[model samples]
Target: MTTTVRIATPDEVPILNAIRTSVRENHMTLEQMADYGITPEVIANLLRTTGRAFIANVDGVDAGISIADSAEGNIFAMFVLPDYEGLGLGRLLLAHAEAFLHATGVASAWLEAGAGPGIRAHGFYAHLGWQSDGLMPDGQLRFVKSRAALTQIVAGG
Candidate 1:
């Protein structure tokens, strides 16, 4: 499927929130995700943030979402829909975030993935050559990749 990435507008908050809920539910314990805690307030806050949000569409249908907060030149919150998994859409979203971060003068990007069930997410990152620096607060694993490094990986791929 052809993929397109673009900056998400405020009107796309609901779609983005739905994508976030879907991704969070996939990684959260069933008991915790039972209620599906996404709210418009959360979406509003995210839209108002300093960071950027990206939406990915496959064949013109919304397929994924990614957000990156600029912190010490480190990008964050790279996520994709489960249905879109294994199709390299995650890598596309991540590359978009990295380019955005790098354009904003970030030399590196960092992401956190669940250590247990979320371990699958690590494979996606590692496959792209991101280096794992191990655990972080909340027991998630941390991955660090330089913008130049990711550029090479994506280019080579």
Candidate 2:
């Protein structure tokens, strides 16, 4: 399927929220996502401040969404619909996020993925060549990749 990715606008909160809900329910454990947050207000605020949100449409349908925060070049949120997994969409969105970070003049990107997701995200990061330093206070594995590496990845594609 042909997938199109674009920057998100404020009006896209509901869709973004829905995407967050999907991840929270299917991928993130309640303990990992934390019930205290994930509210509409919180998600909205994140989309507004941290950085940019990008939505991916596969064959004209919303398939996944990701948020890249300029602060520390974090991959704040990344979720793909269950059906859309393994279609290379996740990698596409990640590359988009990395490129966005690189454009912002960051030398590297960092991300934390909770262990409860059942997706072995730490391994996923490793597959992408992201170096894992250790776990965070939230019990999430931390991964970092240099901007040069990500740029070469983006250019190679």
Top model number, TM-score = 2
User: Candidate 1 — what's its lDDT?
Assistant: 0.69
Candidate 1 local lDDT, 45-155, one digit each (tens): 655775677888898788887777665455445567778877777877887777766666667778877767646778877887789988987687888987777543221
Model 2 per-residue lDDT tens digits across residues 1-157 = 6878888877787776666667632465434445746555665676678677788889988888877887758888788887787787778888888887887778788987765546456667789888988878867778888888774334221
CA-lDDT, candidates in order: 0.69, 0.74
Clash numbers, per candidate: 0, 0
Model 2 TM-score on a 0 to 1 scale = 0.81
Clash pairs of candidate 2? none
Residue 18's lDDT in candidate 2: 66
Candidate 2 segments whose C-alpha is farther than 4 A from its true place:
24-38, 116-118, 152-157
